[model samples]
Target chain A: MGLPRKDRIRAKLKSENTTVRVLLAHPMHTGRAKDEADTLIPAEFIQDIRCWRNDEEVLTIKCGTATARNPYFSFQLVGGKQGDMITIRWVDNRGAKGTTETVVK
Target chain B: MTDDIMQQRRAILKGAISASTLALVAASGLLLPRQLLAHWPKNAFNAETVEDALLALLGEADIADDAALNFKVGSPPSYAINGASVPIQIQSDLNNIERIAVLVENNPFPLAMSLELTPAVSLPIKSMIKIREDSPVIAIIRAEGKLYKTSRFVEVDIGGCG
Candidate 1:
């Protein structure tokens, strides 16, 4: 099977902008954790994240291992209306990727 | 053979096989460097100083203090109990901001995180970051080819990087 879908995205239309919140399921290993066998778990984390609004790029984040597990991010869109498309995609250290979309409500 | 002896023999064989398999994988170079696995931005994260990290990420250009730029930082109490994960939010009113970066001045890796904004995005970028000790948290923004900066001091009881 392919990588699991682990992202939850939501968008809401506010008075003057749109709010987007994203919760991504990830280990965010800091390259320091060790297993029961004492093997160092390699650092695996989301390196890049991009958010698009109706095919228009709005925000991009560059992350590192310091990010916590199941990282959460929230940002605002300058102008968006109901039914507008908001898409977010991220790629992790293992080359695993996930994308999720929501409509502003 | 007795049951105990048979069990011991099987355990030893299993261990030997797994050890050899691990060695083979290591020797074959199947495990790539950790940096290659992600866009780690080694230079910025490895920089010894905040200035160095900013230079590596944003170039060695002069940053001007602009009064027109409305930059605000939202964080917890002045003293944080847990430095490993401190919630922070940045909001600005400067027009046409293209990039925003957060820096923890005293962290081993001062450059905490950064965000690139497009025209469709608004201000107020929120996230969590680790802080090594009591330090000034800086927020830098790039707009119209100029860099605007702001900072707030935060005291940590226990350092994050143990």
Candidate 2:
């Protein structure tokens, strides 16, 4: 299932730091699940995540199959102010990619 | 009868050629993107031991214990019904912290997750991870180019790894 890019990112500015939280929509199939026909579902998950603030990279997360479905990531960005641009992007094992940008609030 | 047989042979040949062409296209389509975008740490994730994983990913496993790091792990349930998705939070007060990695010592693949942080980002990050069995979850933080580490043992009732 695919979701609108903007819906995945949530960011709020608290004081000088902005807390950016992302909820990626993915099945995160661990390659261990069996379908009703008893067939294994090959693993599919977001393998890499990169976050940027105003074109400067802030965080890079290397994820594995152990990460939960519709993974949630929360981190802080220091020295961010209102209306600062924050962009988050991710790529899954299937080579699917998603990116979203939001202004710091 | 001879003409009918020839027609059937041509049809079969056409089908085979198209099938092979489709298969080749599909295989390349599936492979090209993975090779281009793949950046996951396969060596670290597939490492048999935590030390190997750490060495592969961080180039070292000899992390020192520093009391000033203020490393803290948010508590997880003592007995987890489903170890597949256990919520965990890691935070450190150490300044200039560059990276944080989570490792479950007893899992088949011990390296669970790692986050590289820029100076503009804050210290503590929260996420969910899987645990195979009862094991110590190590949180290693890189601060000022030095590796400092700590651990918390979590008792898992059901193993997550297959």
Candidate 3:
């Protein structure tokens, strides 16, 4: 239940802003599902996500178990230029973490 | 004299306006302690019911049905995720958007995600959420120190994505 997941991040320069999309691979277990053995799986979902633009923290996302598996999120970042670095870090309820980074292009 | 009545009405209106202003000041005052000790808002996300979730997150605040805070779910059946993931696109013309959240009324865990964006982030967000069945998906936005919401019913044809 405390397994780490993979992350994919993409940041692109748009008209007036840079759009960033992040995809996280997680089971997002709700503690309600059962395996073939019929045991409840522990809830293991992302609880906190922090987005960073270079050194400054840009935003924080609070997510629950209801977020889909392999969650995808996209947002537009203003004043972003090509080659700027964007980073995403997340921690799930099980204390597992995933971090992804990309350069605006 | 009718002039006396007009004066009284104006005085009452002025008092009402000041009262509302004071109330606004007091409300923002409550946020100071919260910001000082901000966390993941566990009570809100843990709430099972929509009313409880809203109350826990935003307090007993007024919510306006805003048409400007619009959200679209995939309808071309391609957006019709046969599984748990349902894509949603949200765009808002409202100003001063401090926070945005998505909730599915029927999900066992209602609050899917909440975003705290800085001025650097613009609107027209696209995201995915887990929906088990047919339910109303509500997007709540905090803009201009007020809460605005718009909702749409999403039908999930299949079950868990796991």
Candidate 4:
């Protein structure tokens, strides 16, 4: 609700042997300092990640501030045909959520 | 065998061994490129919010939660660095992902960390960035062409820049 923005993944179907790449956008903000007006900006960042293909869970991860911004990723799958779909989702420290999709051909 | 015959046999064996080794190395090249760039999320930059930073980093079409992406973070940081190292991490269980991102809740600039993934490897991203004061940390991911988000609140121990 009042959490920060989140991201998701999507894709088109492709050949069973074809592989795909994905990268989500986020900030690994470390709560540290204040602003010009003497205001404090709290620390916020990502904590976990998960993905699926054709309604089947495939991968999962647990991360923290040590990570960089807009993390990048790539993976492969078998038995995929053109026009198929790929989906991804993630959550951030603020409870914010985001979703996205893609089509492989 | 005679002296001449022995020398010829040694020469032939050496040539055969060298040729076979070279061929083997070349054959392996076919699968090398895919293995190199097949991973995702290689670059990272800072931003102020989840929406602005993500759009600047991942692109428009690659976002979805039905993708079932998930993430977590610390309840609230109990310390501060006056704009120094802020510990944090973002992890995704999605097998088809290549990158992840993090952001700050109240920072003048939010977007913080991002990481790229490689096949046959787990895509867990972590890092610490500068923060102003008390705020929440946000985490996001783009796996298999979808996106997801999460956040955590942190309390500063010492006040510096603030």
Task: Please name the candidate that would achieve the greatest TM-score relative to the true structure.
Answer: 3
Task: Name the candidate, 1 or 2, with the larger DockQ value.
Answer: 2
Worst 10 residues of 1 chain B by lDDT: B32-41
* Model 1's DockQ score: 0.36
Please name the candidate that would achieve the greatest lDDT relative to the true structure: 3
For residue A55, model 4's alpha carbon misses the true position, in angstroms, by: 35
Q: Would you list the clashing residue pairs of candidate 1? A: none
> Per-residue error at A31 for model 2, in Å?
2.2
The alpha-carbon deviation from the true structure for residue B37 of candidate 2, after best TM-score superposition, in angstroms, is 12
Q: Please write out the lDDT profile of model 2 over residues B58-90, one tens digit for every residue.
A: 895568976655444334444466677677776
Instruction: After superposing candidate 3 on the true structure, give the runs of residues whose Cα lies further than 4 Å from its correct spot.
Output: A1-5, B1-38, B77-79
Supply the TM-score of chain A against the true chain A for every candidate structure.
0.91, 0.90, 0.92, 0.69
- Model 2: residues with Cα > 4 Å off, grouped in runs: A1-7, B1-38, B69-79
lDDT of 2 at B72: 40
Better of 2 and 4 by DockQ: 2
Better of 3 and 4 by TM-score: 3
Give lDDT: candidate 3, residue B156.
72
Residue lDDT tens for model 4, A74-95: 4455556676666666666787
Best by DockQ: 3
- Quote model 3's TM-score for chain B: 0.73
- Which is superior by lDDT, 1 or 3? 3
lDDT of 2 by residue, A28-91 (tens): 7778768888999888878898888987877889887777667888888887788888898888
